[model samples]
Target: MVQKDMKLWPFKAIPTADGDNFKKIVIVVTYKGEEKQFALEEISSMLLIKMKQILETYLGSEVKNVVVTIPAYFNDAQRQATKDAGVIAGLNVMRIINEPTAAAIAYCLDRQCTSNGATKNILVFDLGGGTFDVSLVAIKKGVFEVSGDTHLGGRDFDNRLLSHFIAEFERKHNKDISANRRAVGRLRPALDFSCSITRARFEKMNKELFQDCMLPVQMCLRDAKMEKSEIHDVVLVGGSTRIPKIQQLLQEVRDPHVFSLHNIPPAPQGVPQIDVWFNIDIDGILTVSAELVGTNNKNQITITNHSGRLSK
Candidate 1:
């Protein structure tokens, strides 16, 4: 993922362009003497020129057109940006597909979930180096609808650790390490190690960011009008989801005890005869309820595969 600082860099606009228009914010670099604005379209064209040359060299044939995919949650801006990238790369953009849609097709979701021709709710969890998002798809009668968070992703997690390391570096040296390229280059070696160390402290320090990972899951369930128990399974995609801290956040999302038990009303006992209680297990699958606690004749009900669904 491109860092936001680099993407929206030193110059916030193109000096030669129309006043206040931000075309150059996408790409501004020093060329020949003055800073020239090369739209991502132009830069992407440049990248394609080189890439096409390499492909022709290796394949001994001309490469003219290509197909591409983007994130499902990507809005119009991101989709347009990618098409621009393809156009500039010097190749005909054949077709653009959403990454999550590609994943569902690859996994044969319909064939897997369509049991007795009944619809099943599927959640696609996509976490990448730069972004994290979740998609809710309901497959029924060979059709589906999709909804999810497009902007969430892996980069936020990395940023948390990176920010931690930056603050630590600043605290130790009493110098801001983000001043300029030269300053950062001078200390890049030490900071690289800090990146590794940040992984160890990730879950410990980045609580809020981790909580974000669950919001999409909640949103998807709401939009789909399905309880968490209705989800047949979760599909984990992207490289960033493998991070231990990221993985742990998913576990917490599935945890039944993720919410406090304080609001739960104790089970009624025959119009106030005795106390009744309910408890959730850590796995969130089975729960045990005691008809009466601290009584020799206590009765309990063991429920297997409890829905574990949170009521709205």
Candidate 2:
């Protein structure tokens, strides 16, 4: 809810469990001239139902099964809650996999590295809109093992921007907009109040956050019992990874093999040979397959639930 523009919402103070066990997130909203309370999972079901409708329309068929990806740090209760959300959405939750793992699968497949008889250690950096995750994955003979996670992401960066601009607006106008939801929402887009933040200033404002991002990378490497040098490729995933400062920071960590499939420059060739496969079905079920490039040894995993989406 912190990530949402409260002004756009028709409700206020949506009650949530903070730092508590994975339980209920109850929200009240005005609907059809009536105020209604809903569990977070039910809200998720409503979104999923809408997504299912869109998917069915696009595919010209009914959709049921799905694979969801959650943050690697999600506890059992959180994972179960995600599956329950899927069930409530009328989807047969096929499997639950880590978000970083899914990104690794997508990366490996995009690079066609699963069929090659080469083993590589990959660092998957996934910084989405609301969460960040770093995974140290060993792609050995087609098997993937993941190792790190975090909760900070683009939303935190957003908060930094929000705080900065709110202070600026107050200084200029001599009025406090901090408590104004509509004011905050207006400030979010382009700072319509004639305020502009340069990239360097933005980076400076979130210097600590950029540094925090690296902590997970280091921890993942340590947890996986590997050195930074052992990582053959650093795969960047999610929208936040496109930020120039993020790219610069990651390049500082692993310059030569940093890769993103989003039209960023391709990694230099002759690095190594490997094979990987990733597929997403009509229902958004994800399947990852991989193998040593020249060997028959292969491994595969299917991911079905994505509860972390709700947390976002």
What lDDT score goes with residue 245 in model 2?
A: 62
Per-model TM-score on C-alpha atoms: 0.63, 0.70
Could you tell me the C-alpha RMSD of candidate 1 in Å? 8.6
Q: Please, what are the lDDT tens digits per residue for candidate 2 over residues 1-312?
A: 454545433345455565765445587766687878888678778877898899999999999998888887788987888888899988998999888778778777877675776887777888887777787776664324444445577877877887887789789988887676556667777557767788789989899888888887777766667765666777777778767667655654553332222222335686434577756564444455666455555666554322111110
> How accurate locally, in lDDT, is each candidate?
0.59, 0.69
Question: Residue 298 error for model 2, in Å?
Answer: 45
CA deviation > 4 Å runs, candidate 2: 1-23, 29-35, 141-150, 189-194, 256-312
The digit string of per-residue lDDT tens for model 1 on 260-287 reads 2232345655543445564535443333
lDDT at position 183, candidate 1:
43
**Which residue segments of model 1 deviate by more than 4 Å?**
1-24, 30-36, 43-63, 109-120, 140-151, 185-200, 252-312
